[model samples]
Target: MMRSACALAACWWLPLSVPAAASPASAAEVLPPVIDVAGSIGIVTDYRFRGISLSDTHPSVQGSIVATHRSGAYAGISAYTLNGFGELGGSNLELDLYAGYRHNIGPVTVDAGLLYYAYPGSSGGSYEFIESYASLSARIGPATAKLSAAYSPPQDGLNGNGNLYLAGEVALPIRSTPATLRGRLGRSSGDTPLTPGGLYHEWLVGADYELGQVTLGAAITGTDIAAAEARAAGARPRDTRPTLSLTAALRF
Candidate 1:
């Protein structure tokens, strides 16, 4: 009786299989590989990097594209307009190339990557460097917390000096809403341009609201660099002053 029931079950499914096999389109259909590509373009009131305005306190345009593989490896490129700061060798364009891998272990996610900063068409000097970074993040209740570190080895572009940056971030999604609140505290040391006077702390508090394919954001960002230090370093007024920024971005 068990054998008879098994045969009947196979027979009952035969008609469904026959229709799919008989259709030429279904028989010859091919599925694409599982790579995902995503990108975003945006405009910000100021191009802030580590709490310093790279765009000289002016509006800047930026965009990025990334492609990810099924095995957790990804590569991306980002480009933005800058204000031709002296430290950047008066370069107006900044391009970043990066690649990384990310994977989840238990409830925590780990990400590690290498990034290259390139300044094309600079009139004064070479302003390019590379850095390696790693981060670990986990979700707690309604928020996600992350800790990250980035280190650049001694290189010619950095005047034979290097830099280190460590930061912690938290992002919380407002319940039943499309808004998310985010904050970060970071410390920079070594011999980076932004921290010319030893090490300084930077902080940011922001919120993002998603509207279909667009996201709107507002944030207050500042640094602990003193006015005298900023003046000696040739930093602009927006560098150490607490400033507000508004941004709009579209993702595809």
Candidate 2:
């Protein structure tokens, strides 16, 4: 179960909200929670939990709370409050949490924190785990480049588990379309649903368009879950798939 939580957090970090969800109070110039509202909610058209679809089993909801101060110190958190998928014995799903802090040094910023994955229906009987990580971000032209590495040792070997992640994205405006295109790519090591014995290769290509008062965004992510090593190791029913997500935000 703990292993699953760690894997889930990795998904959020990948293409969700960059900077990993900060607090609303921490916004610049005494901003309101509404300022971080978009960052706080990811209405996944398909929220997959533990390599399975939750939008089908449970209307999975993921959100975050962020607080930032003038002193350059900020804290925020992200979590999954429900799952729509059914377990082996037809059990309901639960919630998961990930929170961290960021320290700023001029143009360079650093982040560190832990993630908790919980199994809801089981009376909360020790089905959780923690993932720790460090990340850095810097601005270059019209894009913000970020680098992060996180780790978590296996927990009772039940859920899902993994290792290091190298991911980056570039966000900029398209002069003609009232929209923004954010391109992302990543190389990851450790364990994944597709790669049982080795690391996996993944990439995300998505776009967000803002017109007038509403923001619309869509992304398609592809991953090699069952790598060559997994097949060689007698893995069953190869699982290589694509994940899609869409989000909307209203700014006041």
Candidate 3:
């Protein structure tokens, strides 16, 4: 368990899967530090990650308070809005939150943490279910390599199942230009394969361009989605199309 815990910490520092920093705020309002300080607030016009619309058809308010030090140890909370629950009016609007930490060992890093996903308004009162994630990674030259996994066990409306997500990617900078390209492939598995409880695979191949506070990226994911409603509506194949997503984010 200790080894696994450390491997999980390694996953956080490896740039391949880590999120970038936000726009700089006033020094008087907020102090920025190297290997210190922990907190941030920002908004994204759209919040889509790994081909799924995390904040569909609406703007998202995001906040994070995490800081890493020379020792590479840190902790923080990341929260965002969840538009839908994969069903029509099944649950009210939802919001998700996760707290993570990382520790470094030589060239390797480990990350681990618990995550909470909740729903508020509409149907039932505001409530949320929880999950967990652990990952490990290493770095080499300008390329940082990583292999991370997460387990979200079964729960009430979340279905009695857990998922294991495995992914790896590399990132490199473009000389003289403020841009980076990254490629990743990830697959998820669980107990069942349906609606909000299906085991499936996902692939992500994307790149991002960063200019100061604004950054943009695009990626595509392929999966099998059952379109029974479309089929019943006489829409060609019963299988839905693959998932493709493009994202533009600004941190200010």
With candidate 2 superimposed using the best TM-score fit, by how many Å does residue 187's alpha carbon deviate from the native? Answer: 3.2
Backbone clashes (count) for model 3: 12
Candidate 2 residue-wise lDDT, 1-252, digit = tens: 112332211111111332335565443333423212224455565454333343443344556554443333344455554442233122444444665656667898777777665555554334455567677877777666777666665553224554555666566767777777776665556654323455655566667776554456666655565556545633332243344444433222
Kindly report the root-mean-square deviation of model 3 from the true structure over all alpha carbons: 9.5
Candidate 2 weakest ten by summed lDDT: 6-15
Model 3 Cα lDDT, one tens digit per residue, 163-236 = 56666767766778877767666555555221222444445555667756555654444334345532332212
Q: Which ranking of candidates, highest lDDT first?
A: 1, 2, 3
**Candidate 2 segments whose C-alpha is farther than 4 A from its true place:** 1-39, 48-60, 72-77, 81-85, 88-94, 123-127, 157-162, 176-178, 191-195, 211-214, 227-252
For residues 35-74, write the lDDT of model 1, one tens digit per residue: 6666777778877777777777888787777777766787
Q: For every candidate structure, what is the RMSD over all alpha carbons to the true structure, in angstroms?
A: 13.7, 8.8, 9.5
In lDDT terms, which candidate is top? 1
lDDT for every model? 0.70, 0.50, 0.47
The better candidate by TM-score, 1 or 3, is: 1
Give per-residue lDDT, candidate 2, residue 124: 32
Off by over 4 Å in 1: 1-32, 84-91, 238-252
Please state the error at residue 128 of candidate 2 in Å. 1.9
Assess the local accuracy of residue 61 in candidate 2 as a C-alpha lDDT between 0 and 100: 55
